[model samples]
Target: MAESFLFSIAESLIAKLASHAFQEASRLVGLYDNLRDLTKTLSLVKAVLLDAQQKQEHNHQLREWLTQLKTVFSDAEDLLDEFECQTLRKKVVKAHGSTKDKQDPGVLSIEDVGVCF
Candidate 1:
């Protein structure tokens, strides 16, 4: 009977050890899966950061282009204004010359009534 009891006790100990080993193995697998997920998350974060950096560079370039375009537009406007002034001056000179030819000698000059600078 003693020998039988010893065998039973040994069997119980073996079963407990097996159950503990299984629990440990399950915990290790869970830890490994968590580590894999963390790695993936880190990779995704890195990709996002890289994309943001590229976008920032693009925005900087766009701002520079916009500034250059504004300068060009300002220069064009100034040139247009200068051209318009020249055309207006020519028209006024032509009109003045034509009016002078049509005026009578007895007429008083309109400029005589104005204050002299």
Candidate 2:
């Protein structure tokens, strides 16, 4: 009878140990799952940061191009203004030569026009 009692006690102890081991294993599994979730979150954050950096770089490049385009536009405007001024100057010189010729009754030669362009 004592042997049976001892065997029963041993079996109960083993059962308790098994239950504790199973609880510990479940806790470990939960911890592993949490770690896996954290890793995925970190990866997503890294991707977002990289994308933001690339966007910033692209914006910087666009700004630089805009500045260059503005400079080019300004230069084109200056050139057009210079061309208009030269054309007006030529027209004024031709009108002056025609008036002088009408007053003097002389044909105005190209050399007398003094127009360079």
Candidate 3:
């Protein structure tokens, strides 16, 4: 059960790493090379998962390793999600400009009309 779950997470992480937004975000943050390395590592891990699954039942150490791996994969997925969100947020800010840079067009201050209290 743990093996299959870990395998799925590895696959999901790989797919996220390959996404265009994630790539662009990673490159902007100077993580492109690191992410590339990670992708390669994930592919290798994925390949090993099938074998590991078959053998884990007979090996206690392997089962422990898979559990640890599952935690790492979960962390990686969360990191990717955060990265993607930041990327999208930046895109939105670029498109709409910062809130600090914008003012409510319909609202006016009394000073603008030189009103006396």
- RMSD of each candidate relative to the true structure: 40.9, 40.4, 10.1
User: Lowest lDDT 10-mer window, candidate 2?
Assistant: 1-10
Query: What does the lDDT read for residue 63 in candidate 1?
Result: 46
lDDT of 3 by residue, 1-117 (tens): 888898899999999999998788778889899999999999999989989988998999998899899999999888778767667767867999765436576766443554423
Each candidate structure's count of clashing pairs: 0, 0, 0
Candidate 2, superposed: residue stretches over 4 Å from native: 1-58, 98-117
Instruction: Tell me, by lDDT, which candidate is best.
Output: 3
- Predicted structure 3: clash tally: 0
lDDT of 3 at 64: 88
lDDT of 1 by residue, 87-110 (tens): 455566777764556678787544
Better of 2 and 3 by TM-score: 3
Please tell me which model should have the higher TM-score, number 1 or number 3: 3
In model 3, the runs with Cα more than 4 Å from the true position are 99-117
Q: Pick by TM-score: which candidate is best?
A: 3
lDDT of 1 at 15: 41
Q: Native-vs-model 3 lDDT?
A: 0.83
